[model samples]
Target: MKCINNEFLSADTYKLLKLAKAKAKDINYKYAWVHKGMVYMKKNDDSSKIIIRIEDDPTCMSSNLKFLSLNVNSYTAHTASFELLVTETKPHIISVVETWLNPEISVSLNDYSAIRRDRGFTDESGRYVRGGGVLCFIHKSLKSKVLFISESNHINHPEFIIADVTLSTGSHMLISCIYRRPQGDLLDKFFLEFGKLYPHYNNVLIMGDLNCNLLKSDRASNHLKSFIDDSALFCVPFGSTFHTLETDSWLDVIILVSKDKLVNFSKSKPPFIDGHDFLICEYKLGSQNHYNKVVKFRDFRNCNHQALSQTLNERLRLTDIDPEMIDLDELVYFFLYQVTTSLNIYAPMSERKICRPKCPWITRELKLEFHERDALYKRYKRTGCQNLFSLYKIKRKELKIKLMKVRNDYLKSFLENESNGSNIWTKLRRVGIVKSKQSSPLDHFDADQLNKFYANILKKHLSCSRDFILNLPHLYSKKVNFEFNWSKIDIVDVTKNLQLTLQKSSGKNPDRLDLKWLKDHIPQVSLFLNLIFNRSLETGSFPEAWKSTKVMILGSNRKLKSLANIVLPQIIIDGNLIPYVNTTKHLGVHLSANLSWDFHISQFLRRLFTEEDPEIRRSDRLAAKNNISFKMPNFATTTYEHSFVVTAIRLWKDLPPEIVNVLSLETFKVKLFDFLISNE
Candidate 1:
C-alpha cells in the first residue's frame, strides 16, 4: 500500500507513537501503528502521515437532582466557555450572578431554559444602567416556573428572581438567585423580603454573590451570620477559604434550608477565567429518580425492504376472498394481521443505543489545550505556585480564543445555512424559542380551581344549542348545503381516503398496527373501510367506540388564576368536573388550558418589542403583513408551526373575518379547514 509522509505530528500523536514504538520493540516488531485502540505494525518500513483520529465519548453529566451556582463578574465575556461546561456537565439547574446583561441581549442554551432579571435602570432614555444582573437556567427536562416576588414593588430589593422547581423526588423546592451590590442599600431589603418569603416555601435554596466576607469578624459578615442563624438556614462555609478572585477574599455563598438537606456538595475551580469557583450541590430529595430512562429506537435503515415487499404481497394475495363473504371490518382486521405478521418476519424493529454529540466545538486540539490548562490548575492548587497559575492563565486564554473561533465559525456557517432560502425565520425560532401548550404550575390548593376553569371554557366552546341552530337564516343553510360534497361513497373513494389517512398517521396510535401494514394491504383495507363508512353514513350514526373523544387542557398564565374563580364546577365531562391530566394530545395536536400558545406569543412579542435591532422586528412585521410564503425544508415539513411568530401569522393570514367571526363553532372549523387546505 502507498503511504504519505510527514516530518512531524502533534504532541499527543508523537507521545502515542513513542508508546507504540516501545510496545513494538518489546513484541519483536520493527514498527507499529495504533488504530481503533489496537496496535498494528509492518515488517517493511513505510513513510506515512501517521494521522490517527481518536473519537472521545463525550460525557453528559446530567441528573434529575443537580444544581449549580457561580458568580461570573461579566457572564457575556465567558458565556461560550460557560455554555461548553454546561452542555457537557448537563447540570439540572444553574444560577448566575453579575451577568451584566441587558434585557435586549439573548443568551442561548440548547439544553436549558433561562430567565433573567437585569439590573433596573432609573432613566427614561434607558441609557444609564447598573452592571449587575442575575440569570437562572434550568434544564429543559425539568419542571420549573419563574416567579416574581410581590414585595419587590413595596421594597427596593436587590436583583433576584425566584423559581419553583419540581424535584424528581415528587417534592417541590423554591430556588432564589440573588445578586446584591456592594452599595448595601438593597441588602437590607433583600433580607426582609427573603424572610417574608421563606415562610411560604418548604424547601429553599438561596445562592449568589453576597459581597460579604464571612471570615472577617466585621459587621457585614456578622450581620449575615445572624440572619442565617435566625432564618434556620445553613451556609456552606467553603466561601471563607475558596477565594473568589485574585483578591484572595471569599464573597460568594450557597445557603440552604438545612445542612442535612445537601446530599452532595463541592466547589471546583473552572478552567475558564472567572471570579467565582463553580459550586455543585445535590439535595437529597427522598425517592426521586435522578437518572432518566435510556430510550432506544429501532435502526430501520438496515431493514430488508425487498424481502418485506415480497412477503407483504404474498400475504395480501393469499387473503383474497369474496366481498360478500367477508365484511369490511373483518377484512380490515384480517389484512392488518397479515401485514403485521409479515413485517415481524421481514423487517422487525429493535432497540439500539443512541449517542448524541455534546459539544461540536471541542476539537482534538482544543481538548488537548483544555487538558493542559486543567493540569496546570491542579498543580497550582496543590503547590500554590504563582508560575503554574500564570502558565494556566496563558493556556486558558489561548483555549478561549480557539473556542471563540470555533463557535464563531459554527455560528457563521449556521446563519449562512439558515438564511439560505426560507430558513432565516424558521431557524431563528429554533434558536431559543419553544412553542408548547402553556400550563401554569398549580399547587394542590389551586389545582381544582384551574381544572374547573378549563372544564368551563371547553364546555362553553364545545356545547351547542338547538334553538341557536334553528335561529340561523335559510341563506346559511343554503351555504352549508352548497359546501357539502354530494359525491357517492364508493369502494374506490373510500379506499383512497383510507390510504391518504394512513400515510398521514404519526405512529402514535394505541394499537400496535403501523403504516407498513395499511400500505401493504391498501386494496383490501380500502374496500373494507368504504363499506363500513357507507353503512355508518346511511345509518346516521357511528359505532359507540368510534364516537368516543378525548379532551386536552391548555395551561394559562398564573395571573389568569382569578379567572378560574368565576368557573363553577357545574360542568362535567368524562364523569368529572375536570379530569386529571398533565398534558394530553388530541388528533395529534397537544392541547392545554394555559394553552401554552398564548404564553408563547406573549413571550415572542416581548422579545420582539424589546429587540434592539429594529430591522429584525420590522422584517417580521413586513413578512406577516405581506403573507409571505414560507416554504419549509423537507425535514421541517412534518411540523411547521414550531414558533409563535409562524403559527400566529399562519392563523391570522388564513382566517378571514367571515371564517373567524362565524357564530357556529362547527361552521368555523369547517371553513377554517377549507382555508388551510386551499393555502396548502
Candidate 2:
C-alpha cells in the first residue's frame, strides 16, 4: 500500500491498509487507510469494497442439512477447487476417500473441522504406494470426537475414521468415513473392528468411496447390507458416480442407519477435478441451537463483594427457624440459599453476541464474480464455443488466485484485531492436529441409556456392603475417657477450616456462590455450620447434603497408558530423579521443559541491566550491593504491581543508599511512599 502511486505495494502492507479502510460507502470521511506514511482514499483498487455482513446466525449455518461424499484423488492438489465448492454448498458433513495424503500433509477448511486418517504403509522393498485415506469435515456448529485405529502389522487394514458428531440441537450422528483399496481384501476383519469402535445403537452414517460398484451384482454390496442393521438405508442414487471413456461405475456410496427417514438425495459434479461425482444427501435433523452464538458469563469486574456479604449476613440472620434447632439439611440449604441469592442480585449472567461470517473475505462483489464465472461455465457447456470455454477457464483461475490472497489477508488482520473470545490454543485446535481425547456425544441413545452406562460403571462401588466389615475380626482396645462435645468448639476454628476449604476450591467446578462472597462472610457461614455440626454430633447422624460433591470425568483412564516420549516419567530435581503423580503447576503458570514465563521474566531483567540504553527503566536490585531509593508511586492493589510507573519506581528505589540519600529528586522516596501508603 504505497500511497505515493498506489503501486508496488506489498501483500501485508495492503492487508494492513484494508484493516483501516471504511466499512461502508460514506462521503463524511469516517475511515481512512494509511500507507507508506501517507493517507489515501480507502476504496479498494480493483472492485468496490463490499463488506461481508453477518447476522446473529448466518443462513449457511442453517441451510446445510446435507452430507457430501467425494473421492478426492489427491486432496493437496485439488484444494483450490474443493474450497470453492465448500464456499458455495456449505454441507454440514463432507466425506472424502482416496485423499492420497500422508500424515505430513494437512487439510483445513474455515468454520469446518477436519478429522483425517492418512494412509499408513511401509515400503520395505524400496517401493511406493498411495491412494488410501479417509477424511471427514464437520461444521463447527457440531461437536466432533474422532476415534482413529492405528494400522496393525499383521493385517492390511482399511483406512477409516469414526467421528461422533453432536448437532447444535444436541442430536448425535456417528459418521464413519472409509477408504478401501480397489483390490479385494478381507472385509470381515475390517468391518468387525469398525463395529467395535462405535456402539451398535448409534445413528450411523457410513460414507466413502468403498470401491464397491453396485451396477454389477457383487458380494461387497451384500456384505454391507448384512452388516448394516435392518433400519439401514442405502442413500446413493442409481448412477455411475465414477466415469471413464469406456466404462462408468457406481463406486462411491452412502449407507445410513437411523429411525428418521432421508429427506433428499442429489448428485452434482465435484467442484474438484476427479472422475467421481459428488453424492449429496440430506437427512432430517433436530432443530438448530439458536443461543449457540450468545456466550454467557458473569461480569465480576465491577461487582462489590463486601456489600453482597452484608446482604447475605442479613438474610441469614432473618431465617425463621434457628439453625441449631432445624434439621441439618434444612440449615445447610438455608445458608447456601442466602449466600447465592445475594450474589445473583449483585452479579448476574451477561451474554456477548458473536457474528462470524462464514467467508468474511469473500465480499459481495467477489460472490458476484463467482456467479458470473459460473454462468460463463454453464453457457460454454451448453454450446460448443472454444472462446467462451477459454474465457470461463481464465476467469475461474483468476478468481481462485484472488480468493487465496484475499482470504489470507483478511484472516491475518482479523486474527490480530478481532476481540472474539478465542486464543492461540483455540486457533491450534482449528488445525485439528492436536492428539487428545474429547468426550464423544451420545449417539442414538436416550437419557435412560446414558444413566444405565454410568450405573454399570459404578455398580461395583455403589453395591459394596458394610456387612463384611461389621462381621470382621478386630483388635479390642481399652476403654478411654474422652470428652466429645461440639458445643464448646470455638467459632474461630470452624472459620479457619472453612477458609482453608475455600482457598483449596481452585480447579474445582464453579459453585453457585462466588468464593469471594463466602470468604467475605466467613463468620456468618461458620456460625451456621457450627450449629449443624453440633446438632449432628448430638443426634449421631450426618446430613446427606454434607456428603454431596460434584464429579467431572475427563475420559476413562483406569488402565495405564504408554507415554513413549510424549511425556516424561521422572524429572531431575535437587540432584535427584523424582517421580511425580501428575503435572506440577507454579502460581497460574504451567511449567514445561521447553520454557515458561519465568525464563522470559529473567531474560527481561538481564537485558535491562546488561544492555546499554535499553528500553526498560534501568535500575536492577540484584546488580547493586545496596538497595537504592527513588520517587515511588503506591498501587491500590497487586493488579497494578507490574504497571510501568510501579515497576519503574520499585527498580529505581533499589539504587545505592548514598546515591538515593544525596539525590535532590525526592530523596528516600521509597520510605516516604511506604509511610504515606501505611497511613492511608
Candidate 3:
C-alpha cells in the first residue's frame, strides 16, 4: 500500500511537470522543472546537471531524503544558518527546510500547517505567556554580500522585522516579518509601527501571523486596511491564509511582495483542517529566470471533520441497508423519489383543479389501491402497459371532462338572466351593440318623410364630371381589340427579331403598347406561361413544343402580342423548355387579358353627356376620335379586311400547303398579298 501511494504521488508530480511545461511554452518562458531538495540545472541544450543540495535538519531529513532519492539526484546533508546561492545566467531551483510549531507540529512545506510561536511579552494577568514565533525562508538571487535588517518598537504593538539582502551578482531580496498583537489596543500600534518601517526596500515579502482576515471586513479589520494604505507593499493572489473551521472565516494572513515586482504567480485553495487552516505563498525571483509554479496544500492530516463526513456519506451510499431503516439523510433520498414520481404522474392534466381530491377519504383509498396495483404490475413484468400507466391515463381524461363541464355550466348561468336593465345592457355590450337615447314625438319620421330627406341630400352633392361619363366608352372599348392600320407601325428593331416576328405575324401594333399596359397585362400572361413552363420544367418538354399543342397565343390586342414576345424568351432563358415538339394538339386557347376593360369604358361613356366639367368634355371629344377610331373589320367580307382578319386568324390555324412551303412569314405574306390584290 505504501509503495502504491508513493507511485501515485510520483504520477501526480509528473502531471505537474507536464502542466508547468505547457504553461511555460504558452507564456514564451524558457526553463521549467521540478525542484527536489537537490537542485537540477540544464543550460544551452545540455543534459541536466546537479548544481547544489539544500541542507535539511534531522527533523525533516526522512521526507527530504525520500523526495531527493525518488527524483534521482545527489545531495550533501548539512546544518547551517546560511541562505542558498542562485544566479541569473540560467534558471535555478532551490528547496528549503523549516520547522513548524503551531496548533499542530507538522512539516513547514504543508500549506495547512500553521507555524505558531510566542512573543516574549506576557498578558496583564500573567497567567498566559506570549512566546510564539514563525520561521520563513527567502528564495532569490542577489548581487551584494551584506544583508540589512530593520525592527520597530512601538507602545502596546508587536515588533516589526524587515530584512534586505544583496548577493554577489548585485540582485536584491527583501523579507519582512510582522508579529501582531493577539488582541486589544496593541493591534493598532503594531500597524503604525510597521507602516513607518515599510518604504525602504524593493522586492519585499511580509509573511507572518498578522491576526487579521484580509478576505473580509469587520470592526477589528481596519488595522490591516490602514497598514496597506500607508505602506507601498501589496498582497499577492490567494490572499486568504488563515481559515476558521467554526465560522469558515479567513483570519490569519501572510502578505508578500511589492505588487509591481512579482509576476507569473497563481494561487490554489488551502487544504482542509480540523481546527485552523493555512495558505502558501509561492513566487519567483529575477526578470529573465522567473519560475512558473504553484503554492499548494502540503500536510492536511490534522483537519479530519470534513473528511470524516465525506467518508460517512460514501459508506451510506454503498451499503445494502434499507433506506427506511437508515438515518434522516438516507430516508430523504428515498421519499424524494416517491414524491417526484407522484407529482409527475398527476400535474399535467390538473391545470386549475385543487391538488387534493374533492373527497379526502376517496383520495386516501385511491392512493392505497394505486400502491397495490403498482406492486402487482412490477411482479408481473408489465411495468409499461399494466395497471399504473392505464390508471394515470384514465385519471387525466376524467379530469379534463370535469373541467369542461364546469366551464359550460358557468356560461349557461350567465345567459339566463337577460331582461333586467343591467342584464339587457350587458347582453347588448357583449354582442357589440351601442345603445342610443329614446326619440321625442317631434323627431319621429315615417317612410315617405325619410325617403324625401335622403333624396334632397343626394341631389345637393351629385354632379357628373364630363371625363367620367364621356370617357366611359373609350375605357370600355379599350377592353375589346379594334383593328388598327398596320402602316402606322414604328420603332421596329431586328435585335428582338423573334418578338418582332411574333408581333407582325399576329397583326398587333407594338409601338402603341405602353409600359402601363404591359404592367397590367403581363402578370396574366406570366401566370399562364408559368403553368406551361412548370409542366415543361418538370416533364422536360420545351415551351415552344407545348406552344405547338396545349397552349395558344391568339389575340388582336397589341398588349397580348407583346406578352407572347416577353414570355417565350423568358422560358427559353430560364431553361424550362423541352427538346422535342409535339405536333398533335389537345387543349383550347386560354385567354389572358383584363375583364375590367369591358365594363369601365361603357360606364365612362354613359357619364359623359350628363357631366358638368367643360374642360373634361373637350378632352373627352379628342380622346374619342384618336383612341376609338380603330374599326373591327369583318373577316368574311372585303379583301383588305379579309387579309387583315386572316393575319389574326392564321395564328390559330393549321399550317396549309402554301404556308408550309414558304421559308418565312415575309416570304409567304408578300406573295399572298400580291396574289390577293391582283386577283381583286
The per-model lDDT (C-alpha) reads 0.58, 0.57, 0.36
Taking all chains together, each candidate's TM-score versus the true structure is 0.34, 0.34, 0.25
Q: Model 1: residues >4 Å from true position, as ranges? A: 1-293, 317-336, 355-415, 418-451, 457-483, 488-680
Q: Give the lDDT of residue 552 in candidate 1.
A: 34
lDDT for model 3 comes to 0.36
Give candidate 3 regions above 4 Å deviation: 1-118, 121-131, 138-156, 167-169, 184-197, 256-258, 264-275, 284-680
Better of 2 and 3 by TM-score: 2
- True-structure Cα RMSD, model 3: 39.5
Report the number of backbone clashes for model 3. Answer: 33
Candidate 2: the clashing residue pairs are 628-653, 628-654, 628-655
- Quick one: best lDDT, which candidate? 1
Output the better candidate (1/2) by TM-score.
Answer: 2
lDDT at position 517, candidate 1: 42
lDDT-best of 1 and 3 = 1
lDDT of 2: 0.57
Cα lDDT over the full model 1:
0.58
| Residue range 276-307, candidate 1, lDDT tens digits | 67777776555533333345343456677667
Task: Give one digit per residue, the lDDT tens place, for model 3 in 1-680.
Answer: 00011232232245444544565566554555455523233332454533422242111121110100000011112122111211211111122211212233333322111122223333578543424333333223222222322233232355444445452223454554544544624355545544454555545555545556666676556667766666655665545544455555444444555554444343225432223333334344443222233332222234343433343333334244543344433343433333233323332122232322232123455566566655655554544656666666576566557556754664566567544565556454433344445442224544334333433443453333444444434332222223333222122322233344333312223222222222222322232223333333232223222131222222224424334335342112122231212121111122112101010111112232234453233333433644634433222121132223334434324334574466675777787676567666
> Model 1 Cα displacement at 594 (Å)?
10
